[model samples]
Target: MFDLLIQYEWMRNALYAGVIIGFISPLVGVYLVVRRLSLIADALAHVTLSGVAAGLLMQKEVAWFQGVNPLYTGMFFSLAGSMFVEKVRSLYRSYQELAIPILLSGGIGLGVVLISAADGFNVDIAGYLFGSILAVDEGELTLIAGIGILVVLFFLFFYKEMFALSFDEEHAVLTGISRKIINLLFMLVVALVIAASIRVVGILLVSALMTIPVAASLQFTNSFRQTLIWSVVFSQLAVFSGLFAAYYLDWASGGTIVLVSVAILLLILAVKRIVRIFRRNPVS
Candidate 1:
């Protein structure tokens, strides 16, 4: 099974892309979860799907776009969607959450239209929708690596500010943190993560990678920093195990990865429950 990496360039690219996405997705997810903005990832992912469909359509119909990577177009759309989300959120201060669903619906509608126009890309589109172990290429792996580096640097520079903003937006603002600027930049980062992660986890399941590990980590971790560390640990574990299983069992890579994360979450919940029960009725 392990020999597949040595034999196939696609497998190696998938593994490399998975590792980078596994690390960065949860890193940003921790912040989103803390801020109670998890749904934004889902919205951006849908928007990315539209961009991907558009790219596929253009590639088939226009010679100039034949060599372009759909992932780049997906990134462009995801970023544009993020900015629109922020703008819409500002317009409805009392109903800010409405922004997510609006974009989500619009994204799906546009994606369906574009996909219909493309007409015969079911196989290629399936890879984007559900992730394919063979869909990642050398160029995509490099793009994922670049995105990983950008995410790390963004966190390194803004860690303190993000921490403050996540835990208490009102106080952070009172202390002179620029909520608007920070939020816009954070959304952009999330868009990038979603676009990059789609190749490993697919557009539909990408949010799971971003949120589920963080959810599990919060169960036992006592501090924000510890939670962040454990989230990445759990994510890596899921990616490794999921990829192995996907390879051996011939399952969809995205579904396999998300199910593995879900399994981890369930196991954590069960353990926590048993511990609580034991604490209530100490060994007699």
Candidate 2:
């Protein structure tokens, strides 16, 4: 534990970012799952792949503009892709799901092109594909922390309106809150979180971090606030344990983290079932 962090700079960075991600992800994630927008989060994550690939391909140019850094391009393209998703959602309001497939497919297609062009397809792209607990750097860690703080601030400042919108869009609009603005803001925050998490969890398994905790919380919590708090607890356990396991076993961090979350969720469900059974057969 301490040995790994002491020996590897990357390990330290990954753990730091993972903690921030663990906290913020499930925070906004509860709302997404409640609103049935989990798929949208999944879509935005996939779209970020294009940004990462583009960053790698334009490493030279991006470095020239940003003074020799690849992450700038990655973050830039990610934020742009996120904004694009919002724009697409507005244009295809009647077919909201269409925006996901359109953006997801386009992103992968572009990513493949850029990756092949850069001869980076066969490289150690696992960090971008499945994530690595050893790939995180100081810059990426800072980005995740900054974004995490901003996300919490957004939720804190707009708690009332966000809560209303999450519960019922119609009621929120009826109450004079601009549902459009709130919804767009929610999506934007989701996009930012997903983008910041790409390096830590990758695109494929990012949605798991955003949903598994919510799934677990829903089984035991009826109130929205309770649900959010419990989800954060579950998320923290998943991310921290996964980071520890991935570091020791040298496995894919993204997959490991998500698997850990799922395991916890399953454990919670099992406990629920056993408790119910015991209650029914209390004579023993």
Candidate 3:
């Protein structure tokens, strides 16, 4: 199964997409977890689903969209949805989390309508739900790679500011970090990451790719930067293992990946408990 990367273009594209998502998802996800805004990824992913559904429905109904890729539309709507969330958050500052549920519901509603219009779900749409080994084409691999680079560069450039905002928004504001601008930019970056990851992880489970590894990492890390590093490490482990399982065992890639992530988190908790018990009762 591993050797297929050299033998098939589809396998190579899958590997590339997985690695890109492995790196960026947890990298950005660490900050999201710290800020207690992890649900935002789920909301944006649902929005992306609407866009993807629209693209698929259009391909079926309109002649022009036959040649168009659904991922492009997914990215556009994800970005727009991120901005909408930001606006709604500002409108109800005392209840900021309301925005995520609102967007999530709206996205799911739109996606259902579009999918129904396209005559219900088919194999092509199933790929976006549970993921497919061959779902990503050459162009999408290139786009995912490009988006990975941009996300890394932006994260590095705004590392300190992001940290400040994540840990203490009031302090970030006091430090003149331009919280509004940085937050909007971060949301946009996160939206792009979600759109890019859906090719491999699928829309429904992509949030797990973002948050589960971070949850596991928090069990072992003492510092914020260290947490980010561990999250990416655990993410790579899940991605690689899940990809291997999906390829050889005929499993649904998204579900396999998320279940692997959950397994890792549980393993980490068990390990930490054992270590604490051992320290408390050192042998003679």
- In order, candidate lDDTs are 0.91, 0.79, 0.89
Model 2: CA > 4 A from native: 2-9, 60-69, 121-123
Per-residue alpha-carbon lDDT of model 3 for 89-191, expressed as tens digits?
8999899899889989999999999888778755477788767745678999998999999999998899999998988899889988999999999999999
In each prediction, how many residue pairs overlap at the backbone (N, C-alpha, C within less than 3 A)? 0, 0, 0
Quote the lDDT for 133 in model 2: 56
Clashes of 1: 0
Per-residue error for 128 in candidate 1, Å, reads 0.5
Cα displacement (Å) at residue 258, model 3: 0.8
TM-score of 2: 0.91
TM-score per candidate: 0.96, 0.91, 0.96
Error of 3 at 83 (Å): 0.3
- Candidate RMSDs in order: 1.3, 2.2, 1.3
Candidate 3 error regions (>4 Å) = 121-123
The C-alpha local distance difference test score for the whole of candidate 2 amounts to 0.79
Give me candidate 1's TM-score against the actual structure: 0.96
